[model samples]
Target: MPTAQATTTTNITSTAIDQKTVPTTKDGLPTILNHWDCRSSQHPTPVIMIHGTFSRQLSQIDVTQMLHDRGYCVFGIDAGHNDNLYTLIKPEYYGTAHVDETTDQVNAFIEKVKRKTGAKKVDLIGHSQGGLIIRNRITRYGGKDVRIAMMLAGTHQGTTLMGASKIVEEAMPHLFPIIAAPL
Candidate 1:
């Protein structure tokens, strides 16, 4: 029998492993594009994944495998930046504002996925800013439909890296343009 861990939004259990596989996006990073809809379906809610700052959805290989083995569908958001402080402080597609935008996108995607999959709700797993983003979305934007949230090494408070960034943005307006290019 599997061991169960119950929470407000979902019930998680560790069951005997049947099969484990690596999922990937078009970019070749370990990614979750589909729910684990295998015959052994157990968990009803989908897993919405968020990666840490400068990290890609591909970074969640272990998590994806674990949830997949548990009969849960997993989805990952790339968050639009690489895992370098230089890249994070600089601008890419979403600029430094990617965190909030990514969170909102995650929420929207969750709702859409739920509607399509007929699942009642979703479970969120975030790492670092990935977690913070979810918290902000839930509290500020009213994520009542969210079933479960697990944050690993999450930043409940501000990060020193971000603080240093503020100083950089203030001290070097001229360099900010160059810095923002590779983000």
Candidate 2:
């Protein structure tokens, strides 16, 4: 004689009570890495950490941990396909992907984070090429989801290295094509 309405009410109450028992770390933070409790009163906006070219999320553990300690929900993305060559080259030159490609990746990452966390906006922290990626996302792409952006050693304008890249491009136009080829 139990009605469908009675069954649905029981399911909803059980689910809500189960969520309250979810375990957290010693600091009362969620044990899941790169996850934030969007329902938290203190931190509504999550932080999206973008690694510069040729780097992966693993390289940003130190900074991530620091932010977590300060009670910020932190997330990161390994933009582009540079994981294979990460160990071989210098970190600076490691992220050699075209800006446009990285920007696209950043845009997707921001959207994904926003969806997952149920957050309206996110703060950005970019390092080196990571910085440019976020900038392109915000300016070129429709990145209204971003709340604040901070870049470390980020290049707003193209790097000159005292015009080294320019000189090389001029001297051997064909070489530029070969060097710029996708890995």
* Candidate that would win on lDDT: 2
Backbone clashes for every candidate come to 7, 3
Model 2's TM-score against the true structure: 0.63
Please provide, for model 2 over 126-168, each residue's C-alpha lDDT reduced to its tens digit, 9 standing for 90 to 100: 9877888888888886667778989999978767555766887
TM-score, predicted candidate 1 vs. hidden true structure: 0.65
Best by TM-score: 1
Q: Which 10 successive residues of model 2 have the least lDDT summed?
A: 10-19
TM-score to true structure, per model: 0.65, 0.63
| Native RMSD of candidate 1 (Å) | 7.6
Evaluate all candidate structures by whole-model CA lDDT and list the values in order: 0.67, 0.68
Q: Model 1, which residues run further than 4 Å from truth?
A: 1-23, 29-32, 36-40, 80-96, 162-183
Error of 2 at 16 (Å): 41
